[model samples]
Target chain A: MVEELIIAGFGGQGVMVMGQILSYAGMHEGKNVSWIPSYGPEMRGGTANCSVVVSDEPIASPIVTEPTTAIVMNRPSLDRFEPMVQPGGLLIYNSSLIDRAPERTDIRVIAVPANELGEEVGSDKVANMVVLGAYIKARGTVSFETVGQCLAEVLPARRHDLIPLNLEALKRGAELVK
Target chain B: MAGRKLFKGNEAVAEAAIRAGCRFFFGYPITPQNEIPEYMSRRLPEVGGTFVQAESEVAAINMVYGAAGAGARVMTSSSSPGISLKQEGISYLAGAQLPCLIVNMVRGGPGLGGIAPAQSDYFQATKGGGHGDYRLIVYAPASVQEMVDLTLGAYDVAERYRIPVMILGDGVLGQMMEPVSFPEGSEPENAPQRPEPEWATRGARGGRAPRIVSSIYLKPEELYKHNLRLQEQFKRAEAAETRYEEVRTDDAEVLLVAYGTTSRVCRSAVEKLRTAGVRAGLFRPITVSPFPYKALGERARQVKAVLTVEMSLGQMVDDVRIAVAGAAPVDFLGTTGGVVPKAADIVERAAALARHGAADQATREGIS
Candidate 1:
């Protein structure tokens, strides 16, 4: 099956990193994947998004106009991306930042209080990890272990100490689904 | 020996240049191309190679000139605006007939336009940007792999003709990531020793006398002879340095002519056109300067029409017209200021041109 996802939020919200983690996990699963970023001045304080596609077959165009999954980290992100999710697909919204849930009934919506979860985890920056945790729980696109390992591989060397914290965030996020 | 490793195109170019025995790198940092200098800064010193972050693009190109004069395998790179600054230096290098590689990871421009991918420098690259009647061998690579391969070839060609060579690319090709492999044992400890320079400024040793390398000739007759000699070398390059690639042109009724990133888009367009039952194909000129005119001219005879697609407004189209020589009608489709034309749009134009080819008056009108 072909799955496309878009992770979008404000520039410094770790949204792009969330997309990279998902793409890295997809690669770890031996799937064909591509990640394209929106760069230039559009990335500064403005809304930023990355389009990632993972497929069992070769992907034709890396440009995703309509994605199968939408991960919205803020209200603006939800407002912009909710309409582009395919019907009956998945939408993971950050309930702490987004004031309202998506109005669409055709798609499955999972409202995760990621910022509160991050606060409980002692760092609000892990809010993206909370969203990613909920995504793995909902889609089972990859094993949580694979996502954790991929995270350790992709994080900067100076931040290597954060690996255990990030893994804890992922596990705490997975437990929220239970 | 083909194994894949993920890397950005700019890093790939630096790695490939190192593998191609390029030991001297002089450049200034510019956006979209900053990764190139960043990579070289860390890697060159590890291999005992030289990497200098010049004070400005002018200083960088002149430094390249100095190194090339010393007969070192040297290179310098910058974006469009910086390349504009380097034009005078490039012209001087051409006049001196120095062998060196220069790279332009082009960004949007007419002036300091923006830091976005653009192919607007087609004319500046192909038609000698600085003053003079000289040509620099220009290679445009469509992918990261070609970026590596063509850079290696750029050095070889530069040395063979003793002329400056350019690898012209856009920001997209520089920033995008792809799998690349390092050529095995391709690194040279140093550049091959050049034959004793008859005109190099080698300082006098043991009263063997000092040689001077200058483009300045006070007398018109002397300067005229110098230019004549340069022209002869250009002629030899024109005869030997033309490179291009063709796809499905044997029975094509319409040909899509493009280069670099536009060529990849056109390739996709050609595939779509063929799927839609139109006999359309692609002709990609690898070397933009010693343009593959003979091949293009021969292909023109068999095709009904040629469509030149570029990211610039009709710069490369003129060259296509010159190469086709009225054998087939040449049409243009272009975008500018960092806009890239979609494959569907090119396919639509290709299909339209093919369907109209049979109608004589309609085709003539379409050309006009």
Candidate 2:
């Protein structure tokens, strides 16, 4: 199985951390994965995104032209990436931040209220985790346990104190999407 | 696999240098490659290695010269514009025959182009970015794993040949994260008992004749001889290390040539073309300087046409044309200013070349 994904949001929205966790989870699951961020100047106050792949086969190009799944957490991200989803693919958007809906009918669209779910769980800053949780539950690329462990690994030691809240946020996201 | 984990290419390159026994790092910070110096700053001290964040790129490269002259396994890294600043120092390193690794995680530009990935520096990297007739062993890695492997290999090759070596990557690879591991089993170390090279400067013990590490040959006659000697050594290095990798070429009708990040795109294009029944293949030159010219020339004879792709406007294709040299028709495709070439684009070009390159060329000639 191959899942080419583009996860996008604001710079401080933990978009890069989301990519790192997924890629780390993919690695721990014995899959060939790669994650590349949009590190250009366009990232200043713009949609910060990253391309990630989880595949059973060895990956060739890390650049994703048309992603099989585009998990966008903000309106700018949705506006930019909504058209780049492959036909018959998945488009998961955070309904909390994006007011408008995705117009593409060719692909599956899931609207996850990540910010609302994060606030209910603990903090709204875990909104990125909520969307990531929705992605994993929808795609089933990696196991929930692996993703949790990778989340801990991706975050520094000081952030380890917040694992429980993060896990709860992830669980809320997973349940919301399905 | 015990130590395998996802690492950014720049951080991995720094760690790989440490594992390769590099004792010193000299560098200044730049975007897309800033992690290299940053990682070195934090990690080098832990391993008893010195990390100098030089005031400027010029100072950093010259510091590399000083460390290498003392026979330290040393290195420095920078992006496009910073690398441009270090060109004169690189030339001096070559002129003096000092062995040190230089990592160029190339970003866009003729000037401060962009903090986006590009292979536009191909000409500067393989064909002497500095001045003079000196050459560097340039390795262009296609992946983060290859970045680690080539970085380890680059130091060894540099020391063996007493020449500058460059790991020519791009911002994409440098900023990307992928699972990478150190070489399997324990890598043998350069023991403390390892004898210093005959040319290394050290305290005078037992009154051995002092050796000088100067590139200046005052007399034109001496400079001429030195240039000849440098050329002869380069030829030997070329013979010893001209590496490339070929895939799906056994019955290929069209061949694609690329390196570094673009090579991975071409590899995907090869697979896609095969699915479309084009019989496409990829020829990736791992060592872009001592480029696998003869090997590519031989493979060119087996194909109907050759297409060279790059992130620049046809730099490496100059080398490709030299290698293919009348064997087959050569075509070129490129993107500029950090725009990545798509795999679909490559497939279309290769398919057209395999299907109607000859007929199309003939028809156009007839019409004209």
Backbone clash pairs in model 2 (N, Cα, C under 3 Å; residues 3+ apart or in different chains), count: 0
Candidate 2, residue B329: the lDDT equals: 91
lDDT tens per residue, model 2, A1-178: 9899999988888988888898998898899999999987655467689999999999988889989999898898899999999999999998988999999999999999888999999899899888888888999999999988886788999999999999999898899765
Q: For every candidate, what is the interface RMSD in angstroms?
A: 4.1, 1.1
**Candidate with the greatest TM-score versus the true structure:** 2
Q: Candidate 2, which segments miss by more than 4 Å at Cα?
A: A42-45, B184-193, B358-368
Clashing pairs in 1: none
Model number with the top DockQ: 2
Query: What is the Cα-based lDDT of residue B176 in candidate 2?
Result: 89
User: Mind giving the per-residue lDDT tens digits that candidate 1 earns over A1-178?
Assistant: 7888999888888887887787777766777666656667775568888877777765544445578999998889999999999999999898998898689999999888988998898798888888889888888877888888787667999998988878878877777775
> How would you encode candidate 1's per-residue C-alpha lDDT over B1-368 as one tens digit per residue?
12555567788898888877778999998887888999999999988899999999999999999988877778899999999999999999998888888899988889999887788998999899999878888999877778998987777788778889999998777875544555665655544554654555556777877665666777989989988888888778889887899988989999999987788778768877989999988999998988988899999898878999988888989889999999888999998887777787888888888866656435566854
The C-alpha TM-scores of every prediction are 0.84, 0.96
C-alpha lDDT (0 to 100) for residue B234 of candidate 1 = 73
lDDT of 2 by residue, B176-245 (tens): 8999988664343542444787788875689999888889999999999998988887898899988889
Candidate 1: list runs displaced more than 4 Å. A1-7, A18-36, A42-44, A51-72, A75-96, A99-124, A129-152, A164-178, B187-209, B360-368
